[model samples]
Target chain A: MTSLGGDRSIGRLLASLALAVGGMGAGAVWAPSASAKPPAPAAFCQTYPDSKSCTTGFAECATCHTTAPARNAFGAQLSERLAPGTPRPLSDQAFVSALPSALKMIEGLDADEDGFSNLAEIRAGTRLASAESFPKVMACAPDQASKSGDGRWNVCGYDPNYAFRKISLDFCGRSPNRAEAEAFRKIKGEAAQKAALGEALDRCLVSKYWLGSNGVVWNLANAKIRPAFVIKSGANPGPVPLGDYDDDYNLFTWAHSGDRDVRDVLKAQYFVRRVSDDPVKLEIIPEEEVKKRGRATAQPVPADKRAGLVTTRWFAASNTMFTAIPRTTAAQAYRAYLGWDIAKMQGLLPVSDEPHDYDRKGVGAPECAVCHTTLDPLTYPFTRYNGIGGGYTYDDDRLKAYIRGDGPNVVNAPKSGIILGKPVKDLVEWADVAANSDPFAMNVVRDYWKVIVGREPEVQDEEEFSRLWRGLKDPARYNYRVERMLHDLVLTTAYGRP
Target chain B: MTRTAFIPALALVAAMFAAGCSSLPSAGSEPAQVASIDPKVKFKDGDRYLGDLARALNMPRETVCKELGRYDCFSDAFRIVLGGVEAPNLTVHTPLEEAALTAPIALDRAALHVCTSRVRMDREDPANAVLYRASASGRPDKAWMETTSNELYGVLLNRDPTKAERARLVGFYKDVATEQGKPNPDAASDWVTLSCFALASSLESIFY
Candidate 1:
């Protein structure tokens, strides 16, 4: 058996193997020479920056290569310099030595021709390879002061009326009513108008309309699963309408209301459900009653089995594959809470001979071990939570029985699992671990930014994104209160712009 | 008519009316469809559109709902599908093409079915008629028509119409009335159609 070192090693092996196998049976005899060896890893900019290090936010390998060997313009340029001779692989040492000259060669070049040089683009945290991803160059006169109504500044500059419209529409799910619009127009100066707009935003954030059917907050939260509420169980089982799971929306609305910390979405002890007679009124109950009364009854889940939304029926139903504790549940939780995909991160880890039962015999071979080693362990703690039953169960007896009869031949089936490289004993611990993690904070900031800014947070927006992330997690500032974070987001220069 | 023939006929009528209105352009000239609005521009979605229209027109929510049968009529006209599944209601983002293509036709049909019905009901009651009231002399004049247009624009578009826009609309009303011939008892009906077209087809009415 051969050991697969990692993604880079496997990629190199595949490249060499392709070359070796190409000339075979074509009257060309190929022999393995003693001097021949697998090429060393490319010294990617992040791992081996030249004399001037790649700037902040220029950290991921994806910055150059969309994925290795599939080079973006910047990556293509580097490839041309480092492996110019018939596309031969460059060793790590060779790559490191070649990088300095390669970097100097492309310093002033505008690869994508979006008006910024490669070095300037890298420093500005803009993508050098994509014209669409370059830094936004707003045309402004030298004398055009910030926030002035000169009309010289491009849409990137603050516009009071535009910002007001955005705030009302994004936060309240409607255009400003006539009274509000007139009031905004009545304000005399830009400063006064901005102050009034801020006040209006505060009111909109707490208004019942913000928590209503068309609310932006509700829409953003719902985008994760967009649960169908009804499921066709399997052959002959018929349709199962989990109308009770509508409580998930109610719980989200409640958690975001008033001074409630949005983090309570993961940490709240109780869940909320709409009153049957009046769909508007909601009742909160402890988590323990969820199993006995169903999620529609607004009940509490037991402490050991609870992890806020993760253990909720809607989340489980939507994310899980039927009849088992699917790794999909863990992956969704990671994405929803931590803003990272385990599958995407697989390339960063070295391959192992670890066993993962779900993978077919040859599928989990060393070449694919990078993802399973992390993903399988992460899903171990979730085994206690039954997928089809629509509730949590501490008794692993059923899980053990399922594993024996029908589940994967997962070795060691540890009681504890790992998250973001830290060990978590159970689903509850997983929530706590995630709730306090930086990625979770960043994810919250990123989601809210996307909704408020009306666009994806690009690398050009990284500085502001980091600032917002820090402000949100900072107890002295927003203290993880989502309302305050949202307020701060609207006040940011980016949100105020057209 | 066969379903295929009916669809093409409807498309032809829609295209003709859209071209007739110089203010409203064809959908083909619009940019590529985006899943989200620019926030700086773009019209409100269905919920806000219906809710605001109900408020501006002083029409009851139930009356609007009754006229526009839930998902089959107006909602289907502007609905968006994602990955072969219909997105949740109120989450559908109408691109410019869909809005331009569907809004005029849907609003016109709605005006014919719903607004015309409301005007007929108002004519009988006279007391609760928000659009038109019984005149002492029972005569339609330029002043009354201008006041009516201003009131409609104020309520629907939330801004007074420009001098040029108001003149164009007034000319449109006269043209439409002449086409129907003089002493047309349906002059009020003509005004109703003009009001609906002016308000619903205007960029201000469509975009926030």
Candidate 2:
């Protein structure tokens, strides 16, 4: 048999073989009991004095005899004396000792019947009423229901079947701020307006309170989209519904821990205009929506070799790696290029048998190495961060903990591999490090900005994107700018593209 | 082609003008042909629809169809332009493009009035309800309705605003509740149709 090494990666096979050796040691030394023989031995031992062989004393003559009935009877009596102490009484030890050949006879009858001697059972806790009499086992609770309705918000109520899909929003019941409400109240012939306002108020009340009541149900149904990374961390990361365009808008609750980041993207501050300002003005310009419209292009990897081009491996699900939004061409390009780099870092480029020495949090190195031996290009961009706050914050500790080799708790682990030589604790730091070292970061931002806003990133625009990415390096801008960024993104030509 | 485009634009403007003056579509008079209008027809989305449906049913739009379902692109557009609700089932009596087209004009208008009046009153403005004289005949157990409205309002207020569109559908049966409350024989006659409309539109009655 081939010998196995004791490396942590190879420990399971080694442990199994060692257990086999232990089994053989017990089987070789065990012996049978004297009580197993027939009572005919009694006749033989009793007749010994009458037979020619009995001419000598029976104890002396019986040395060559295989069958001795009187000796067998003595052996049984001696064995009884050695039986283990129980709650009940047994014959006296003195009576047992009076039998001839007591020591040898008692040794043949094994108590406890474990491969080990009775003394060993006493030492080991294995000795009990009987081996068949099982120790009590505790029963486990039933599987936790995802949709338990005992929640304050209808959204919190559990439904194992509803997957995250079809989110919607309405401003019903929440009249505009005081100024707006007062202004509307002043319209004299405003019956229509008043009615409209009432409707809006009702919509607001429902959307704000009841929209996501079934989120747990939806999440449970679509387990794959259940934000696996967030769930593993033991934190209440809020909920995500998984379905494609079943509802108007994707509704996320304010109860979300990542609300700040989401708000930043919406640019929900006073400075930014409401999305509903000019309803008729909304138009989709598809061609102008190309990724990174005017941004610098990412270094291209050949198509055939581009399979391993994804850079952010923080969260990949269903075996497909991606980003939340790869709105820009540069972002997409960098994703492709970095994906290949990651594959190389993991020794997938040379197609070697050796595993990559990635940190404990990485996904593709050892975890995915067994499947895809070669590099593959990234097909999508990294737009959404699946970690604790908002999207990607770029914190060093968080990033390190995520892609370090061992998986982070399910909440923070990135399914894809990390960029080589870049400093990434969280998404924000990654942006900073990318700005300084990976020219690709700048490219991604520029392209994404242009795509989202439907306008080319001018000097000011480029400067702002760079500044946002850089300022966020300190992590302050991570969750705060989601609203602004989202508002800006939707305003871009890139946002309208397929 | 330009002339044809101009004609459609002119028609739309004319339609709007006509709509503003209450030169309403002859309820049920138009043949019930299922012509496919743009899904984005103005006033068909979420709160607008709920509001109109509530008004037609003589109930509070806000208190009834409080949650507006998801506003699709079309629905959003419809919401922005919606003017008022009419009880069209009383006049127009044919199943046209969608259900609304099939309704009679008088019935639709009546429902719309009721919804608007009641909703305006429900919004912490008891004076509005008093002014509209929108009292339920036979003294609808005012306390029960009040309690129900309060419960619904609390649920509505605390809910995430984004889901307002979808959740508003819970008021689908507002007409039924209002009909049960109304003491007037004339109003009660039309209550069943109004209630059916409300029930059909609610999120709870539909998707939920």
Candidate 3:
């Protein structure tokens, strides 16, 4: 149940701060005072040039700093050395005078006390603030050393040839041919063999089998919910086949195949569809037009209306029930997108004392409000979107009927909602909040880690997991490119070992 | 009746009895001492196994699938039942019923049909000239059998057979040839048939 382990407590604390300071705006709350004497930018920048505060990239200071003045362990250490204030242009002399002391102070400190020194963590591109984040240094058993004194087999515990075969089957969905196997075996020396194996993995990632058949992209999507054209029929009519589901699959395949940013899954303004021809070409359609096409044709929706996979017809159909205001839809979104299941109260949101009833009373009552406080508000924006039967519509009357009770005037129905304690007027704002949230990135990393390692990442893996997450978020490195993430994963000790 | 006529009838009956006895093993005799080959290889599921088979045989997957009766051979034979509601790519995660009653039966039937067809198609083709030569060499010697066994092992198991294994398989081939009779014109085809069966039904061939 505790997937994140002891780090969950720390994560909970950050979540609380994020929610409590939600209204103040992330930048406003985190930004240091402008009037205070600014730090020597050149000194900090020169030392940790790749740090977000020092660079203009996706992974910035805010990644670790939930609030700037109140920094996390990593941020605090940096702030102490660099001088606590907003970064500003400083003279070279002033920068040089401050650089040595700050660097010296953090040199030997294990800020999070995860055993790894701050310098080691920084050099390894691991998080210094989180005890959970550290490099995994694998130790080999003494008996495993080869006669030739090559420790490769000792570390990996798998014959390079067998490892290559397994990697090919797992990544490419088939075994290597005789020629391919021979070519791989012909490579002499452990280093050369390892390099060749890595190159083979890279080639497999782009193979037709990986792209079309048993590829990671499709498997990742399937793991969430099987891409279905129709749900089974019982008392209610089965959800009809919407061409959009196939479009969703094609879009995912295209993104991953192209090695494009995977964050576009939640943030892209267009959906891709393959044209029916001898040599098919994928076309991107706008969100509004896609909605108008319904299940009749494949097209893109307008940028503002699109919410990546969340707004897809298949997603809505799979998650929603017959009822108009499908609370399950919101719950699924929270679990899938944010990586926290509301039913389990994983986020540990505060409970307030109030009376209970189904008519607003239940939502506000102290006992019921424990979960509904977050659940109801989170579901408010979803009321605009109807269930499977309604398809994808923005009709106000349909929205009203859905939120209100079917028979009567339900004045108690929520008119607005909050996401991670941030107020959202409607689903668009909700999507924006969900898309840019830290939980979104963390969830993605968690999912990918599971796919690559074939197991749920334990608490011990939090440091490496965070590094992967940071890389995905950092536009400078991978930037939400899943292929790059997969490449990184294949090269990990976990992937190489049994 | 004449004594000559009676003697001729007795001789004809003796010849028939002798032929029948030759076909059957002697009473209290042990079964043919066939070598037991256990590669300790586990079975791959339908898709992977079929893909491997097609690649190793240099045949199109569609042809192999069709010859094996498609789903019956690949899915039902392997117990990968694709129910009406099941997705095509949804892998059945249950452990394969390697010891199930029907497993051997199904494997035998499919391997016999496919391997026979593959041998028949390749026998006359120049591409399989080595296989044809080995089969048609009248009587296989130790060196030839060893070479053939190694080649077959490479194709099926992706490795060379050990000296003991090659010797055992060659002994099997010799026994098969001797049982078919020396003057049998179909001796080559029968040898190839048994060899194909051995490769196809092998633990190495069935498993990864």
Model 2 gets an lDDT of 0.27
Could you give the interface RMSD of each candidate, to one decimal?
9.5, 27.6, 12.2
> In model 2 chain B, which range of ten residues has the least summed lDDT?
B86-95
lDDT of candidate 3 at residue A197, scale 0 to 100:
79
Each prediction's DockQ against the real complex: 0.15, 0.01, 0.06
Best-performing candidate as measured by TM-score = 1
> Ranking under TM-score, best-scoring first?
1, 3, 2
- The CA lDDT at A1 in model 2 is 19
Q: Output DockQ, candidate 1.
A: 0.15
Which stretch of 10 consecutive residues in model 3 chain A shows the poorest summed lDDT? A1-10
Q: How does each model score on TM-score?
A: 0.75, 0.24, 0.62
Q: What tens-digit string does per-residue lDDT give for candidate 3 at B100-138?
A: 556656665665565556666666675664343543455
| Residue range A17-118, candidate 1, lDDT tens digits | 222222221112222211221121223344434311132212444546665436788877766666466345555456566766776778788887877777
Query: Candidate 1 at A121: error in angstroms?
Result: 4.5
Question: For candidate 1, lDDT tens digit of each residue in B1-208?
Answer: 2334333433443444454445422223332221111133545555555556667667764465344455423345443321112323343322233334545555555544444555666677788876666554566677677776776667666767656556545555554443223444555555654565446544555554
